[model samples]
Structures are given as structure tokens and as C-alpha cells.
Target: MNEYPIEYYQFFIKFNEGDYYTCHDLLEDMWMEDKSNLFLKGLLQMSVAIYHYSYGNVKGTRLMMKVAHEYLQPYRPKQWGLDLESVIAYIEHCISIIPDDIDKVSFSKIEELPALPTLFLYLEDD
Candidate 1:
């Protein structure tokens, strides 16, 4: 199957092409289909994080990045060559430049990554 929705890549292309709102709209559709889909949710959070970062809301951006990290933790996107580490790494890199006086500067760094493990672990119980 295709790795992501047509709209997903379209959003990135639009984002790179400088259409922020369009990106949000695309992700909103995926969000509506399944509120808890980790992939969609994580990407949505990523879009928001980068947007906020660009707008200079360092705190808000960091919060969104943290949420994105939490959302991806369960799946370990690296296994599939997804760019989860780079996402979090970029956010953290930005946060590092923020003065320590910032109130939400609490989360630690992401030092390693590996893709989600096989679900076979649970299947053996059957």
C-alpha cells in the first residue's frame, strides 16, 4: 500500500510551496476519519509545531513537538524509514536555543530511534 494519503504528501508539497493553511486543511480531513490514528495525529502535530515555530511561539511549538513525540513513540516510525527522529530532533534543536528561563523546557533529548517492533509479539499468545 502507499505509505501515506495523497493529501499527506500534497500537504508537504503545499507547505514547501508556502501554503500553510492548505496543509492544515489536508491533515484535518485525516484527523476527522480517526481521531486517534497515530500517523495522522503525529503529522498534524508536526505541522502545527513547525508552523508555531516559524511564528516565534517557541513555547507552543515545543508543546506541539512534545505531543508529536508522544504520538510517535508507540509506533517507532524509524522502522519504516519514517522521519520521526528528524522531526523531534529539529524541534529539540530549536528548543535548545531558547533560554533556559523558558517554562516548558523540561523534556529530554531523543538519542536513538528504531522502527516499531513487530506485532507478532502479541500473536504468539493465540
Candidate 2:
């Protein structure tokens, strides 16, 4: 397997720590450096979407999830040892739980949202 970029590893470090916002910052900078990298952009959007969900920003959450799904879907199965399929599946799972109407979900309802697993756990071991 090809080695992942240092930024990619660092992104996971922040993401696995429940620091999705930081993950978004880190990956967004990296993605900016390589705008042609669809995978990086997808991961960046996923991070931001998760961060939005944590803060109960339902609109932002759905918007970013849609961006992430659109960008990541074409690079499925795996990418640079990361299991994109599993990552996409996790994103889909998150999207599935969102209320049809954001207004229907209160703060307590947001609190009741399921805790998502770390995407690092789905990484393929070299």
C-alpha cells in the first residue's frame, strides 16, 4: 500500500480525538493545497459535517454531508490505504439518522444523536 501523506495521518489524529473541527481545519488546509484531490476534499467536508452535527447546526450538517457524499462516492473501496467505502458508509449512516426537518430536532434530540465511530478504525493495515 502507498504511504499516506503526513497531513492525512494528522487529520485522523484530530478526528479520532473527537476534534472534528480541528480535523476540518487541518484537512481543509491540505485540500486547499491540492484542490484536484477529490478524496481529500471529501474527507474535509466529512469532518466539517461531523463538526456541524456536534454543534446542532442541522443545515450545515446536511449541506456538508451532501458535499462529502458527492465528492467521495467515486473513490470508493479504498484510497491510500483508507477504506473510503467504510467511510462513505459511516457518512451515509449519519445522514440516515438526521430528521427530515431540522426544526423537528431539538437540542435534546441532538444530544440523543448516536455517537459516531472513528473512521480510523476502518483504515486498512498496510
Candidate 3:
């Protein structure tokens, strides 16, 4: 088997540990410098978009998601359909979360979610 660079593991660590932005940033470097892994590249872009969406960065989310879609367009999503759809929903939800009268106060009024929103997703995202 072939090995990828340390940067890949670094990105994975950050992603698994929930340092969303950091993982996203590291993945960008790998995506740009490594030409041998198109699938990995697409996955990383999707991860970045999801990370950005997790932080309410709508534009960043859309940009990366679009890139991911383009890259993966040649393949059949059936293999990773659920994960792919999940990411797409996450990106869209971030955009939808905004409303003309989105009161942060509304969120505050709500009790804690059943699960704390996941900050970092690992191999799945990266």
C-alpha cells in the first residue's frame, strides 16, 4: 500500500477532534499539493464545506460543497449516498437556519439538544 503525507493525518486528527476549521485548512493544503488522490481531494472539499456550515459560514459552505459535487459527479453516489446526502443537508440547513427574524434568543430558549451538535467528524468527513 502507498502512504500519503503527514498532512493528511494532521487533517484527519483535527477533523476527528472537532477542530473543524483547522482540519479544513490542513486538508486544503493536501488537496492542492497532492495530485494522486482525486477521491480524497473531493472528500476533503466536502469536509471543508461541512465545517464551514457548522460554523454558520454559508458562502464558504456552498463553495466547497459545489466543488465536492463537481469532483464527485463522475462517480455513482450509491456507494456513499447517505454520507453525501448528509453533507448536502448540513450545508443546506445552515443556509435555512437563517430567517428574516432569526432571533438568537429563540435558540437560547430551547433546551439542550439531545446530542451536543458534533463539532468535529473524523474519517467520515475528511
Candidate 4:
């Protein structure tokens, strides 16, 4: 089996750990190098959307989610060993749960937000 890129592993780890900001940062470098890769851009936008949501930026989250969905649509079911269907469903769920007005969202309100699942890429056993 082929080895996945290091950044991919880092993305999975950071994203699952609820560090969306770091996920965004880690993927940005890769996205910069391959601007034409919609997959990378979608993943990066997804990370940024989550980061925005985590920080109570409703508008930013909404905007990013829309773009992320669009960018990711072409690669359905799977891409780069990722389960795009599951990831897309998760994003949809996020869009549904994110409040229209996040400014007044308190800690308790934040607690109401659904927990995001981690993307598990297929990897070869050592």
C-alpha cells in the first residue's frame, strides 16, 4: 500500500482532537502549493469553517461551509482515501446545527453543538 502524505495524518489528528484551527493551518500549506486541487481546498475550507464556528463566527462559518460543500461535491463517496460521504454528511449536520446568531451563543449554547467526527483515511498496516 502507498503511504499517505504526512500532512494528511496531521489533519486527521488535529481535526479529531477538536483543534480545527490547527487543522486549517496544517492544510493551508498544502493548499497553497496545489491551488487547483479542489479536494485540498475543500478540506481546508471545511477546517476553517469549523474553526470559525468554534470561535462563534456565524457568518464566516456559513460562508465557508457553502464554499466547502461546493468544492467537495465533485468528489463524492471517496477521495484521497477519505470517506467523503461521511464527511459531507457531517458538514451538512454542522450547517444545520450552527446558530444564525452566534454572537450571543454562550458556553451552554456551544455545548448544544454537535460533536464533529474525525476522518479516518485508509492506511496500510505496518
Ranking by TM-score: 2, 4, 1, 3
Which of the numbered candidates is closest to the native, going by highest lDDT? 2
Q: What order do candidates take by lDDT, descending?
A: 2, 4, 1, 3
Total clashes in model 1, counting residue pairs 3 or more apart in sequence or in different chains: 1
The global C-alpha lDDT for each of the candidates, from Candidate 1 onward, is 0.57, 0.78, 0.54, 0.77
| True lDDT of residue 74, candidate 1 | 72
Q: For residues 1-126, write the lDDT of model 2, one tens digit per residue.
A: 557668777887788888888887888788788899988889888888878777677778888888999999888887777888778888888788765577325566677665655565345674
Question: How many backbone overlaps does candidate 4 show?
Answer: 0
Q: Residues 25-68, candidate 4: write the lDDT tens digits.
A: 88888888889989989989998987876655667887898889
How far is 21's C-alpha from truth in model 2 (Å)?
1.0
Higher-ranked by TM-score: 2 or 3 = 2
Once fitted onto the true fold, the runs of candidate 2 whose alpha carbons sit more than 4 angstroms away are 103-109, 112-119
Candidate with best TM-score: 2
**What lDDT would candidate 4 get against the real structure?**
0.77
Per-residue alpha-carbon lDDT of model 3 for 7-113, expressed as tens digits? 77676577667676686677667767766655556667767765554544546655666676666555434222224454445445543543324222233543421
